[model samples]
Target: MISSANILFEFICFVMALCFLKGNDKFTLFTKLYLGLVCITETSGFLWMMCTNKSNIWIFNIYILFEALYISFGLYHFIKPFKKNVKPLYIATYLIFIAVYLYGSFTRGFFKFQTTAIMVASVLIVFLCLYYYHNLMKSDKIISIRNNLGFWWVAAVLFFYFGSTVYNLFMNVIFSNKPFAYEILVYIMLTLNAILYGIWSYSFICSSRHQKLLTSSY
Candidate 1:
């Protein structure tokens, strides 16, 4: 039930991104593509599970690689307007994450989740989101917070990733507790996904409204 709701949330967010964010700019286009990939990857995971009756970890393993890259780039896109010299920071983080992820994949095999790599990526993302907030607060652009698409989008990412930090860090311990802990984690994931996609949908709407205002002013 909860899993289905998360899937529904994913689809809804993807549709919203398509309708509101498509073709606006390079970042928006990349966002649209990323959301599309999310939908496809999710659907493929379910189908793979149904057919093989086995773990589809490999699908998500590959997905996370792109997820990290796209999200890092998205943060960089938003942050570059304020800080010109941040490219190396973003690039270096990606390099570290890719190396960690590859090591996890090779050592544990693709069938296992790369928990360490995920933790690293999630922690880094949370920090980047904080950095974004820090810059936004210090900038003269404070008045645009209400309809700032990038702000809202990054907020959603922060909430989702930060909220999942506990689960990501304690996956083995949680699973070791058997059905109860597992069920708890499932609910946690459902809530996290809701927060993520819910805010993403709203951010798309905000972007649409902002664009309309700009168009009308001309």
Candidate 2:
């Protein structure tokens, strides 16, 4: 019987396929790039875990590097649609994250530092999203669009992603001896991530439609 993690991985792959087929045109070029990276990282991580039983530590290390890169780029693009100057800062942060990931991968003692960095980045991204939502809420031009979809979608994604990270961190630090418990936590996180991506794809679709309508009206 396929485990829940396997099932969730399959579902994530299926959703990614559907997103490529149906929502490719809706996403911005940056969004597309980040999404592609995310798909690669996520699938590889899942496969590595399932096949190697955490023995292939290098794969997990690479996965973490790629995931941080993906998140940094994703946030960059997500905000660039409104805040352009922030791109450079995001790039700088990404480089720092990459360095940290590399160090952590090579040195077991540094793993805790990497986890802390990831948590900090995640929190910063959530704050950025909230700031964007606040500005959009006050803007009259696209108030309806922002209110109806953008803000909520961003909030949902941040909530799940951050929540999962917290749980995984706890499992890693506090329940290190319980392998099965750690596996379950990872499975839950993967499922939440897949759901978050689906919501992100839908939000891209909505944003595309709204933009087209606005252009046509003008």
| Candidate 1 residue-wise lDDT, 50-100, digit = tens | 899998888999999899999899899989998999999899879989999
Query: How does each model score on lDDT?
Result: 0.87, 0.58
Number of colliding residue pairs in each model: 0, 0
1-218: candidate 2 lDDT, tens digit per residue? 22455455445644544453333443345455555555565467657778877644454455566566655665665566566598786777777666655666577553243565566556656666666676666555555654234554576557765676667477556556766677667567666765675666556556656666667999
Looking at model 1, residue 41 earns an lDDT score of: 90
The whole-model C-alpha lDDT of candidate 1 against the native structure comes to: 0.87
**What's the TM-score of each model vs. the native?**
0.95, 0.68
Worst 10 residues of 2 by lDDT: 18-27
Clashing residue pairs for model 2: none
Candidate 1 — which residues are off by over 4 angstroms? none
